[model samples]
Target chain A: MTYINSFRTGLKEGLPICMGYFSVSFAFGIFAVESGLTVWQTVLISLFNLTSAGQLAGVPIIASGGSFVELALSQLVINSRYSLMSVALGQKLSREVTLPEKLFIAYGNTDEIFAVSVSNEGEIGTRYMAGLILLPVLGWTGGTLAGAVAGNILPAIVASALGIAIYGMFIAIVVPIAKKEKATALCVATAILFSLAFKYVPFLSFVPSGFTIIISAVIASVIFAIAAPIKTDEEEQSNG
Target chain B: MDNGKFFIYLLVMAGVTYLVRMIPLTLIKEKIKNRFVLSFLHYIPYTVLSAMTVPACFYATGSTLSAIVGFVIAIVASFFERTLIQVAALSCAGVLVTELIMNYV
Candidate 1:
């Protein structure tokens, strides 16, 4: 396919992902404001971060005057998966994507975009990656702007209801995968158990919230990786 | 938050996030062949999200009962393979309706 055709195909594939991001980021906007961030601040976070969970996790740290170390550490732990994704996607890039182009593409290497790009039939070019990243960036930032503005105007009850929106999105992402894969289901269950222990158990409760997330996720993932090593071929087949 | 401090925070976040992505994409030319590592990476997102969701999501709304209602609604919607927006909108609606009912009672 020509570059334009590749780009157009990417745009087509990205439409649904863009639409999905809008609603989820809208909730992020509302939640951020409720947590004390101004509308512009919330919007800026989405613009720069382009990550749902990382932004959600970072807002609390920012609002509560948590240290920079805490904020940076939280983002690193929460978003570390992007490193793995970028490495995977990088392997599929066409030679046309030089270092500068890779830098540009890296900005949009989000979970859904990476998934869409990697699932393509052959080598992915720079134009296709650009087209794929564009709409979702717009949707994510635009949704945050709209939701942040609406957040200031919306009633308390409505805002409160919207609080669960991100978590709802999180559940949506995990449930289907968990249902299809036994290891994933057990992993999720184990992580939840760890999370609850952090919240309720006496000594663990003293652990900072960011570390709680890091520790719980890491411990659960390590255990499951050992107990149920996935067949690499099976993993690719499922992803594709 | 002071303007300067907030910007610093944003910079740090965007910086670390960008580097994590950029370094690997720009430099890595080979696929990682470690079985344990691949499986671990596969499980990370699910585990991180699940860890963040529980207990925290249960208290998301004003009332735990309403939050539970929303959580269950989201689970059901997604179980049927609903799209992300549909699941999110439904969960929000679920919480709103439950809370409104709670007020009446």
Candidate 2:
């Protein structure tokens, strides 16, 4: 009963995430097919990668006959934050979680799962996180398959425009939190400024997109940490 | 990349990604105690999401004006703490309206 309830809750909580994943993954599928990948290959990549940005960055390299090392480094640069997210999640999880369960849950860690899990209270068990993971993975995979099957049916302009859904989803996730939290707002502003600097500045213009994202995130995180460290217990208690 | 080699590369990449995510949990029995590290971990999602979204909002439509309109709409909608769907719908609608009016006038 507990497992069933957790699954139900996960499904409900994950609906919006699933919708966002579907749209973005669908776009990826369309792009993959147009890039000359077969349906099976596209589906397999989505299932294994489960990362929009990483896949987007990698697809060009793969098409261009880039080396495996280049592909791996690009993926590492883009998806390195998942390591941080996983560590945070590991801290939130019960210490008693078995090795196998931890391994399984780690595979399922994505932006959506991390957001939903971290926002919830208390020690999150593997069971509940698993419920959250399964839904989005399935949604993403299914959506990719659908997109590949329906490839190029829509006009190129429309399909290209729909790619903006990924950005829309990111905005929906960040804007609300930034509005309420000063630390988050600062982090957002710093990241944007640094990203623009990397893009527009003559010397920085040569930096790759994947590296730019990683560097901006690191710089923003550091600045926010220095400027606004977490409040102490006495401060919190006094305020309360 | 040939078909066989591409699949092989993907399998290796997936294995490496999974290992990077899982190894710390499996090996590190002690809790993370460093405050700076913990705080950095706490802020990664926020920083990454913001980094992705901010530029995207401004650049997604290939014009600074559209991005500003989209950001304004998204910011207002997000203040209400609405669901992702609602925020996305409202922002897209906002972008379309802004673009249409710009074109007509």
Candidate 3:
């Protein structure tokens, strides 16, 4: 596809993500504020971070009066998945994708953007990713701004219900991919079981939420790689 | 949280997040030649998203019952290849209605 066409398609394909983010980040706004962050601080967090889980995870630590060490470590563990996503996206990126572009685009490389970019039919370029990331960034940050301003105004029932929307987006990413590949199905199951084990096991219970995510993801991916290495040629067809 | 400490918190969170995304994209210049390593990278997307989800989704909302109800709706809707918005809207509605009913109970 031409750059402009790919760029437009990227934006069009991203509409659902934008809408979903608005609702989800709206909840984040409320959470941040209810947790005692001023509206500007909440919006500032969204503006710079653009993360759902990391922000959700961190704001509470601050509200509960946790230390900087706890917050930083939590961030490193919860968001370490982005490093894996970055490597995966780096593979699909056009050679013309430059240092400056990579630097800017890297900030927008959340789960949804990575999913949308890799699944595209043509060479993934900067313009396309920029288009893809733009609206969601707006939706994510804008939603937070709205929520920060009027978060407490919403009825408790409504505000809490909106909380589930982001998790819904997470499910949307996994299901379609898993349906197409048994290896992926196995990987997801392993992740779920591992996450549950960490959550429920008494001794392992102290493993914080961030570390639990890192460990589950790394183990599942590593095991899948060793057990079922796709031939390089077969990779193209299987991935699509 | 004071403004200064809040900024420090935001700085760490934003900085580490950016570093994670930047390091692999900027540092990894060539195709990973190792097959095992290549496979690992290939599977990371699916695994990481899945791992992050699970237990988290089931606890996304206040009411565990309503959250499970929403979680199940999401999985089923997405399984049928429903669009993301459709799935999210459906699940969110599911949570809202479930919570509404439970509130009355």
Candidate 4:
């Protein structure tokens, strides 16, 4: 019953997320196919990677015959947030959770899952977190496979247009929180400044997008922290 | 696509990705004490999203002029705290219109 209820909750939260993933992953599938990867290889990548930016970045690297070290470093930089997310969720989880369970749940950590997990309050057990993780993974992987199979059925223009959905989803997540929190607003502004600098500044222009995101995130976080510290009560609650 | 090499790569990628996520939680069992670190993690999402959206406003199309015009329109719309969907849609529309005009003129 506990697992069932958790699954149901996950499904409810994951449905809209799945809808968004369908369009983005569909595009990824087409891109992978066009990039000389077979359908099975594409499916495997989606099943394991489950990160749009990481996979998109890595695909080009692989195609260019980049070394494994480069691929790993790029993924590390882009998906480093999962480490932070795992720590945040670790606080919410029951202390008695086995190491194996933690290992299993960690596999499914992505931006969307992390967002939902962090936003959930109170005592979050391993089972519930697992449900949250599994449902989204399933949805994303399923979408990728379906898209790979349905390749080229949709017009190129339509696919390109729909590619914006993932960006829209990110905006949806950020804008609401930024409106409510001044710190969020400041962080966003700092990130934009740094991002533009990385892109336009001649010396920094050569930095990869993944590394740029990591650098911008670190810089923004430092600025925000100095400007506004979290209140004691909020800290206590988060720690608890 | 050789099935054997493909599956090997998939397994290696999965293993590496999972390990990255596991290391912090397994090693840093205690609460995060460094104020700077906490602050950094807290603001990462904001920075990432802003970085993505800002350039997206410009450079999405081939022309820099259209990007600037589209970005100005988006900034004005966003000042009202418009919904994301509305802001994105409007910005995309702005870009399309600007490009179309630029082409004909």
Candidate 5:
């Protein structure tokens, strides 16, 4: 495919992802403001961080007078999976993607975009990745703008109801695949159990939320990897 | 926090996050041949998402009952194979109705 064709393909795939992001970040926007951030502060967080959970988690801590160390540590832990994803996506890039281009593209490696790009048939080129990142970025910023700027205009009940939106996105992402694959289903259960245990248990509750996420994901992924190893990429594409 | 501190906070967050992404993409040029490792990474996304989601989901709304209703609605909506927006809209509606009912009940 020509660069334009690949870019167009990227936009096509990105449309659904963009829509998903708009709602999720819309939730993030409302929460950020509710948590004490100004509209500009909230929008800037979404603009630069471009992460749903990390920003959502960080803003609250900051609002409550948490230390800078807490903010940094939590962000690193919550988002560490991106490092692993970066390695995986690195292997899929075309040779034409230079070092700067690779680094540039890597900055926009959100979960939805990673899944879409990796599922493509061939090595991903710069143009395609650019297209993939573009729409989602716009939707993310746009949604945050709407939520932060016009959130007060929304009726109190509607704004409150929208709090469920991000969790809804998470459910949308996980449920279909879990329903199909027993192992992934098991993995989700394991992660949730681990998360709850850490949260409510006596001594374990002291574990920071960032570390808690890493431990749960790593521990559960390790368990399922041993029990039911997925040997092929074909199985993965189907899982998504 | 003042503007300077918040600025520093975001800058650090952005810097570290960019490194986490950039370093891996720049360094790992070859496909990892180890199936054990690949299998492990295979499960990371789902597990991470699941870990981030829960307990939080249960307490998201003003009322626990409304939040639970929304959670259930989101799960049920997912089984229908609807688009993301569809699922989100339905679950939000479910939460709205539940919250409104809670006002009276």
Candidate 6:
């Protein structure tokens, strides 16, 4: 793809991800501020971190004066899946994308960004990646700033309503795939079962939410991966 | 924690997260060959999102009934393949409307 064409395609594809991030990060801003983070601190978290779940998990740790080791471990555990995604995405980059650009692109490789980038046909270029990352970053930081400032001013009804927006987006992403694939449906169902066990089971309920997510995801994926592994070379075969 | 300490924490958090994303993309030029691992990675996003959504989404709206209403609305919208923003907005609207009705009652 030429630079302008690649960048424009990226901006077009990134629009939805940008909008999705706005609502989710907006909720994060309010939640973080409510959990005792300053507005600036909350906004800065969104600006630099960019991972919603990680930032959401990190705020409480920071607020409570948790140890650095505790913070780092939590972040690693919560964000480890990104390593897999980055590896998957790396193979898709066009050769014109340099080492430094890859490093910068890696910074914005959130789940949605990775999904959008990897689903595109052929090699992904530097400008395309840059364009794709731009709006979501802006939306994330801007939404956090807006939500932190509006936390007090927004009525209880509106504030509470926004809480479900992120979950709605999550459902939007997963449900469509689950609908199309039986294996995905089974994986999601199993994960939900594990998630509920962690929430309600005695003793198990004490596990931190971040760890709960990782454990559930790992177990569910393992079961399905063993029972119904996808072709490893599936990506190389353009189905068209 | 003080500002300096907080900044340090944020830096560590960002650094760890960034490295998790950066190192693999920068270093791993070859496509993963392991079938199990590829399948695991392929399934991870859905599983993680599912695990996160459930139980937590039930408590999201602060009222279980409204949360359920929103959840159902989101699921239906998504089942119909609505855009991400459309599903999110519909669900939020559903929750807000439900809350308003509950309050009036």
Per-candidate fnat, comma-separated? 0.78, 0.48, 0.82, 0.39, 0.72, 0.88
Return the top candidate by TM-score.
Answer: 3
Q: lDDT at A221 for candidate 5? A: 91
Model 6 over residues B1-105: C-alpha lDDT tens digits? 467887898899999999999999999876668898888878887888889898999998859999999999999999999988899999999999999999999
How far out, in Å, is residue B74 in model 2? 2.7
**Higher-ranked by DockQ: 3 or 5:** 3
> What C-alpha lDDT values do all the predictions have?
0.83, 0.75, 0.86, 0.68, 0.82, 0.87
Best by lDDT: 6
Better of 2 and 4 by lDDT: 2
Give the Å error, residue A187, model 3.
1.2
> What lDDT tens digits, residue by residue, belong to model 6 across residues A38-80?
8998888898899988888889989988889999999998898
TM-score of chain A of 6: 0.87
Instruction: Compute DockQ for each candidate against the true complex.
Output: 0.64, 0.51, 0.77, 0.37, 0.68, 0.76
Candidate 1 lDDT, A1-240, residue by residue in tens: 222327888888777678778877877888888898888998999999998878988999898888999888888877887886787677668866788999999999987787667656657888888888999999999989989888678787887787787778778888998999988999989999999999999988998665677688888889988999878765677898
Clashing pairs in 4: none
Superposition TM-score, candidate 4 onto the true structure: 0.82
Model 1 ranges off by over 4 Å: A1-9, A30-38, A57-71, A84-97, A111-128, A234-240, B1-6
Per-residue lDDT for B1-105 in model 5, tens only?
467777877787777677778888998877776777887877887787788778778877778888889889889998887776777788889999998887888
Off by over 4 Å in 6: A1-5, A232-240
Model 4, A43-78: lDDT tens digits are 889888888777877777665556677777777877
Q: What ranking of all candidate models by DockQ puts the best one first? A: 3, 6, 5, 1, 2, 4
Interface RMSD of predicted model 4: 3.6
Pick the winner on TM-score between candidates 1 and 3.
3
Error of 4 at A160 (Å): 0.8
**What lDDT is reached at residue B60 by model 3?**
78
Model 3 stretches astray by more than 4 angstroms: A1-5, A234-240
**TM-score of the A chain in candidate 3?**
0.92
Give the DockQ-based CAPRI class for model 2: medium
Cα-based RMSD of the predictions, in order? 4.1, 3.2, 2.5, 4.4, 3.5, 2.7
DockQ leader: 3
Give one digit per residue, the lDDT tens place, for model 2 in A112-141. Answer: 678878777556777777778887898789
- lDDT tens digits by residue: candidate 4, B2-103: 666556556656666777788766665665666766666666656766776666545444477766665665565556666544554565566566667776
Q: What is the interface RMSD, in angstroms, for predicted model 2?
A: 2.4
lDDT score of residue A99 within candidate 6 = 92
